[model samples]
Target: MAEVRGRDTWTEELASLIEDSGVRYGGDSPPTSFEVHAPQSESGESLKEQALGFVMAWCEILMELGRGFRDILRQNLINEDSYVVRKFGGPCSKVSKRLRFLNDFLPEDRDPFHAWSVVFFVFILALAAISVDPNREAVAPVVKVRQHPPSASRVLLPDGRYMAYHEQGVLADTARFSLVAPHSFLSSRLAGLPGVKASLLEEYGIRLVTYDLPGFGESDPHPNRNLNSSAMDVLHLVNAVNVTDKFWILCHSSGCIHAWASLRYIPEKIAGAAMLAPMINPYDPHMTKEEMKRTWEKWLPRRKMMYSLARRFPKLLSFFYRKSFLPEQHDEIDKLLSVSPGKKDKLVTEEPEFEEFWQRDVEESVRQGNIRPFIEEAVLQVSNWGFDIKELHVQKKCQTRGILLWLKSMYSQAGCELAGFLGLKHIWQGLDDRVVPPSMMEYIERVLPEAVIHKLPNEGHFSYFYLCDQCHRQIFTTLFGTPQGPVERQEETATAFEEEDKEEVLQVPV
Candidate 1:
């Protein structure tokens, strides 16, 4: 029974299995005992003993699994009383009692039971206890799981100080959803050199501070955590790194969402922001689902199938998924998934830590006993929350596109709305073939005409990693004349990611 529960991901199915198993065992126990007194053939006696042994073994395994599960839950800080104690009581009690009963059966004097059963019983119980309280503070080692081939040729920077370096957008680590490493390239061979360090100190005089978004990299996973809150966490990290001065911001693809959103809310603290293949929505917020369907209809034929397969076989297809990002279109998907206006390129695949995050989510939902439809509803809620933010404050009837437009207007107007507000001297690089359509960039250019747009021909989405040297040169030029500003520090008060610079604008009547 414990094995049955542990094997299934859903709570309902596991609960049902436990229920049925308990009922069968409960009803059959007396009959089985009565049959033990049969004066039948020796074969019948042997069969009865075998059946009893099977029942006992099954019960023992169930008890161990239950114990192990309980340990995992408690260690993970999941309150088991929320679900098991209140909702699923019978099974839990049965498992505990059976294990206790089995303890007495372990003695050699009692029917000469097998020594292995006793050994396993002791091992499982001990393991359950150990696993339940296994150091709550344990941190997983960071590993690089993927990198681009050409990026393998670039020299890697040292790890001691905060230095700026680019990652060749390969899914290298399984730590978080979309953790772009500081200087991890495709090649382990090139990482030995202090190339990234030299570039940061010499070329830009900037220190490198790396971070993992909530569901990615070195950060803890919060499956139900809101995106706005998660984005704020990135800003909080800036203070934690002791960088007390305004720093240049650069982001690729989906990362641009948080980067841009940060700049929008806290424009004064940002010296400049450079978005490579940044994700921005061109659609209006009010567009209907049908309209979105119509807009995506062209890609729907392929995208739906891809989404289905990716969901079904996440582990097997993760490699191919990374490969799909072209050299020039690294930031393309970020823009595509940016359902929020100005938040394009938001790809779900960037979150390698999703599984760990979801494990916590599952544990919590199970504990709450609101497991069955909650998982399905949670996915939709995640989608809608991000989508709704993009269309905030639109009085017009909401269409899918209109909704996004309304959100864009509200979000953009709230920030620095001055003429030179977005004057970052940005050198934008975009690939036409990537997930973000060329049209999205054109739209942003229309709004912020001052941004310098550089289109990389013949490259797909992720080509920026290969063009690091050129990007570095452009950034170096921008940093040389711009005097370094004093770092603005903030208190580590709330996990709330408040913008460092929150300037209020006074609107005057004409």
Candidate 2:
């Protein structure tokens, strides 16, 4: 009886509302109480009045919807099989329930789970509790890594500093050619033209010497070090190793700065020089617009930004170095350096042998875990060098200082001799090298016209020079001509190269 009464009551209320609203099955005219009015221009309705009208219209529509829904609910109570009742009891009723439940979960304001904050609060607490390294406070001489076991030979300099060095090829006393190679940035004594084998070096009768720079590998750090000090260190190393004859200097990439110093300060000690993809000051004032454009374009934007920072704002580098290199930054080495490797370079770096050698060398380079040495090296690359590249050309200069001396020179000829490096200068360039652009070679040729430039059409920085035996043979043959066996020990006149001799007396300054 109650269900029948409820259905009858809902039907009567719906019929009365529809009649009052003047809507019927025949589309009959609305009642006198209902009126239609168009908005008038003269009325000039304000923004607030227009907003009120919109709100009133929405309220009427919502009231109608509410009535419809209420009638449907009454039908459900009476088991009247309405559309809403059919949907509620549909086959997918469980799926609908799941959807509604999910929609209510993890809401921003209110949650029924009562456990959402548990994970978040626990995460925050765990993060606060974790501390891998408790000591963050740093002072002078903060070692970034544990001290490594000594693996290289050490030499004590006059300045009470120790230098680490490695020797390869034939015995120094029986060598026809002695090459003193100062390694490039992020390298140590173990990097002697990397891929060139021991037997090949023997066939050429070449004694190769490579050494770690200050604050690198097993070498002691030099206080207030510069390029001049760098050259002097090489000079001290050679004297320590006992190269009886004038030795050649080999340079690659930015490491050429040290060799350039050797050429400038101790020109008399060097026999000749061989440079491969040698880098000069990118910020050199002598660079032409075209040269600058080509050189700077090869680097990625990040690399360029880093170089700019190193050039202008060097003090900020420590913060970056600490985060990257000091904290075991082993991945994407070339990317960090802002260099894009060529196809050949990529192939070489991917090899297991090359990868192993490179990782070990890097370990030795940052073994001390200090950043100052790296900073100084970066600054030196762009800083003012004492001499110019033009000074290296073989030319004669006869100059009189004073007016009187000039007048006297008119009456009598003055003594004039060769003014620059008289020895041979050979440069090997890889065309596809991205680190040192081909424009750099152009600049070198423009300034020092006498330098021999050997262009490798398809070679890259590492591919042509590093660990390739055929390439090594070609380089040796080009430099020394046909290979000859080691010279007799009696014929050698170089200083004694004994393993026990670690210290050399500071006889003559470089």
Candidate 3:
């Protein structure tokens, strides 16, 4: 009784104080007091109380429903003049008046439609529980990466950024031909044509140059990089590396976007393009019905969704990329890329050598551990490339599009000129590739009819490109006719001196 009186006194004092304050301020009177009642279970826990309430509420409702069902069942079994019995059941009963149902089996207790509906609902609920990712609502990662220094051979670009690069085969001056190979997504300069031996390159006299994309590997990040900037970067790289003559652009998978950009912006600098399992824009407007169907059907639904997200809502890409690749513990390549690999691709990925190389290459790729560069790369793959593949086809174009240009073209030789890239394009497509479907190759062939397509049977996206020396040799032979060996760089100064001093040579011999 004393404790209750003390509590009541405290409540009264609080109420009086609140009333006095409200009156002093000339405001509306506040609530004198409020009670916070925490409904508790028998065990004195609120959560258990909530669970009990929830179960009881559902049970109460279901019990009523169950009663109604029971009444209906009883009517159907006992009442002969029920609505359903008088309708369809009458004729059946009349025809089977003399017949009897087997009592061994339970009477029809379950309605087929209702039972199936319950099963379907349960199935959908289970799928919803599985498919609905909670991370979709998540914004950031828990574990963040700290800054780390570069770990690759670097070059200074015009943009004042260091580009990481790797040189294979012969020296630049001794190179008969230069091949600039840009790596695919989640790869670095270290990924330059895996399993391609130095002897093979020397035999062909080809200088194979591979470089990291901006912000990838040990390279400095570009603030506002795009396709045009990508082409400019490659141009600067080749010039920096002393590639004076036009060079071939080699590509694999998504890396072909850079090659396409080079062909569009700096066609004069590019001699040819060799693409293996090249990726095309999924949202390209020029795709025909059959092409779109065949191309889209080859990919899993998740990949299509990812493409749509990258193309339409690129801002959302950071979230997904952060979840997959930005962290130290990342998803598998297929899961990260949302690719459904075919059998050959699975075999290639499962190889011990492929795993080792892929792990190292991926580490080098995400060395900087910055997500913006990856976001930029993903956006570049699906967004407008500023030029179409058909534009690379050799064709004549006027300085202007109208009749003034045409009228001038009839008189002036400079009014019109050959506009498109005149170089040959060699595309090697794996027929069983799931990442980049063969239909994309078909589309490329359709647009640029001059591009020759070589089909690889039973090969996958990675099988032919990853670590197959035979495939590499075949690709080399197809692009470059025969192994010509390294260039015999005749020393111009030495030759000139020898020619001018033949008398000295003759006197010394005597």
Candidate 4:
């Protein structure tokens, strides 16, 4: 009996507290009473029952508070003179009309208990509708790890910059020679074809190394890096890898300038060099009639515009680069997929394998953030290279048995069986290439007269990927004695446009 009396007393006090709270929140309401009855049990009402009675009274207080907040909000919405209501006229008017309808439905003359009961029932229904299942397991957020290709690896330069590189072919061969390839703008080392590993191992036995230039891909950006400084970084990379034997250099498009710089700076270290559709010094006086005509009409004007933009309106150029070149953006991908094929489709837009490769390469190029290095590389290409092209022309004569012939023969008998293949430089260019005009080939020819010229009549800037098998066969045949086997080819289906190669529509940076 004493326990029952105590529970009743607690319940009465809880009801009184709730009634006072409701009147305080609801504003100028008549006196109201909340009678909370404690459940009777034969074992007597436990503490749990008393606690539940208090919780019920507290819920009633909360419902009254919610009603007060809603009424306040409705009053604010109905105020026509208020700035908030005037500014949001349509929304405020709708809210005011709904509130008025609710008020009319529950008039001031209506019983207070009946009106509060309706509000409490509505609140309970809303709570039930939105309630979450307590038994449900919460899904953990997925943590994504950015994955690079198998060929990708990072090295720390002496200057503390992290340099990303791709190494392909055999690394364990006793007579292995390193072939360093520098990628062009908006391209990664994955752009180069190192041939099938089995064939490279059995025939040439070479490890092809390619890296992201400063400001592109994973390499740290050097805002002030010039062509010569980039060459120096490459040399440091070579030394970091601890390659004692003379290495070969292969470059494409704008990368040719760096190759030339390497040949000048580290002449003794370079065995041989090759440039495919190599970008030439535009100011070279030895340009052919056709080259001069293209330069004057097409190339020069385009370069002048780009240079001016990069120099004066860099922010504008940066904005363009982000919108146009970023692979993560669907705009670039959509543009590529929608472009119509013509003679301009020199790249592997029609080929699935090459397109996939090129897409991944572009994606990785800007993954680190900032396209400034790529832009700087472009500007450096059109501007002065800080070294004369004539310096690369000074060839060291090979001595019999005394001095090692770095570039004398394509294959070397002493260090590598493929060392003799080192000195013979090749510069392959396409007449139809719009990215770097065929006229640029004339400038390369003038500077490096000894460089064997392969002029493709039908191909354009990116035709090498389409004719990748042929290129491999040609390269092997030139270096090694004969072609090993039939090269694997990408599917010949027009999947997307080689939008990157469309220099006229989309400006080629270098």
Q: Quick one: best lDDT, which candidate? A: 3
The TM-score values for the models, in the order shown, are: 0.37, 0.67, 0.68, 0.55
Going through the candidates in the order shown, the clash numbers are: 70, 2, 0, 10
Give the TM-score (vs. native) of candidate 2.
Answer: 0.67
Q: Which candidate do you rate higher for lDDT, 2 or 3?
A: 3
Off by over 4 Å in 1: 1-197, 281-427, 478-510
Q: How many backbone clashes does candidate 1 have?
A: 70
What ordering of candidates by lDDT runs from best to worst? 3, 2, 4, 1
User: Is 1 or 4 the stronger prediction by TM-score?
Assistant: 4
lDDT digits (tens) for residues 1-510 of candidate 1: 665554443544644775533322223122243222334585588799999999999999999999999898786544655565566667767756644544553655654245656677997897578557655224433222232222211111121222122332212221111212111111111221113334343323344344433322222334454545534554555544434556566565544555555555555556666666665432434444554444344343344444433334334334333443222122222322222222111222243443233222222212222222222222322143353223211123332256766677665654323333343636455443344545555555655566677776654444443324555555445545542321221123222254322222234334
> Candidates 1 and 2: which is better by lDDT?
2
List the global CA lDDT of all models: 0.41, 0.79, 0.82, 0.64
Candidate number with the higher lDDT (2 or 4): 2
Clashes of 4: 10
RMSD per candidate (Å) reads 25.2, 21.3, 20.9, 25.0
lDDT of model 1 at position 275: 63
> Could you give the candidate ranking by TM-score, starting with the highest?
3, 2, 4, 1
